[model samples]
Target: MKNARPLPSYLVQRYHGWKATTHAENKAWYRRLAEEGQRPRAMIISCCDSRIHVTSIFGADEGEFFIHRNIAGLVPPYAPDGDHHGTSAALEYAVTVLKVANLLVVGHSNCGGIRGCHDMCAGLAPQLEEKTSFIGRWMDLLRPSYERQAGIADETERLRAMEKEAVLVSIENLMTFPFVQAAVESESLTLHGLWNDIGEGVVECYDPDSARFLPV
Candidate 1:
């Protein structure tokens, strides 16, 4: 706490601008949200990449979504091992307490986490393979995905596939939670996978029918 400093000058200026315009305009809505508490309709798990903005992409308003962002937007399989589990805890709260109707995992193109996992699996990134690296351990969840796409001869296509595969892998891992599986089976909750191309402004949803990601 001692190391913390005041807000940057630009951020302070921007905050004042937002407070004068956006916040002022939506004062009643903000007040109502504060009073009512959140009852989000969906939980979106997305990459930590600053470029991927779930609300902006979905044209959503505040309180409409419960979002969790992490590297590669990965979700680990359910493990109640007493240690800290941020993503899993979020998922549990979303499904059980919040009772969200939908759970979505959004992956994106040029994901540094995915690329690192790919390279690490291929013996190309020794730093990521280090035992002390938290990212390396987190990315180990995607090793199976990397193995599946490692044989692709084209690098571009392979990375793209890995990005989408990350979404699918997360979705698969989500099912490993008993509560999630029960909710899904009882029609109380639904799971979705999506991939976005950052530069192209294109979004795609996984089509389980064809096992492909088609434009959304």
Candidate 2:
């Protein structure tokens, strides 16, 4: 523990400022949230892109959402083989424990993780193919989606298609969990897919009826 690092001064200062301002202003609400515990109605699985601010975009309150962010916001195929599965574990907790009414797999435009997966599959990023590469292995979950979009001829359109596919793929994989499947079947849970364009400030929701992403 000797080499453990302390938080940066600016971040610490910001925390202090928030503690004195936002925290003080919303003291009762914060205290109630702490004492009563969180009961978020929605669970959001989103990319860990700094530009994609899920909370800010949705104007969600502190305890309104149970959010999980990873490289591509991916959900691996359910395998109860007693292995470490962080994303799947979180998904299980959300669907079973939290019992969120809505589960959203939110993908965003210009995802570096998706691009990396595309490049790796195309033999452009050799580093990602290494067995020791964590990102590479994690992105393997998204490789199927990349292959699904292989028919697209234009690079830009294909990239966009793959970005949207990330959400679609996660939704498909999420259903592999028995609890999630049960919840949806009983109308206890509703699954949603969303893709955001950060630059254009546009959001699209996947319509299962039309089988296309429509502006929302």
Best by lDDT: 1
The TM-score obtained by model 1 is 0.98
RMSD of 2: 1.0
List per-prediction Cα lDDT, in the order shown. Answer: 0.94, 0.91
For residues 126-175, what per-residue lDDT tens digits would candidate 2 score against the true structure? 99999999999999987877788888999779989999988888888888
What's the lDDT for residue 127 in model 1?
Answer: 94
Provide the lowest-lDDT 10-residue window in model 2.
141-150
Query: What would the per-residue lDDT of candidate 1 be over residues 1-216, giving only the tens digit for each residue?
Result: 899999999999999999999999999999999998999999999999999999999999999999999999999998999999999999999999999999999999999999899889989999988899999999999898888997999988998999998899899899999999999999999999999999999999999999999999
On TM-score, the candidate that comes out on top is 1
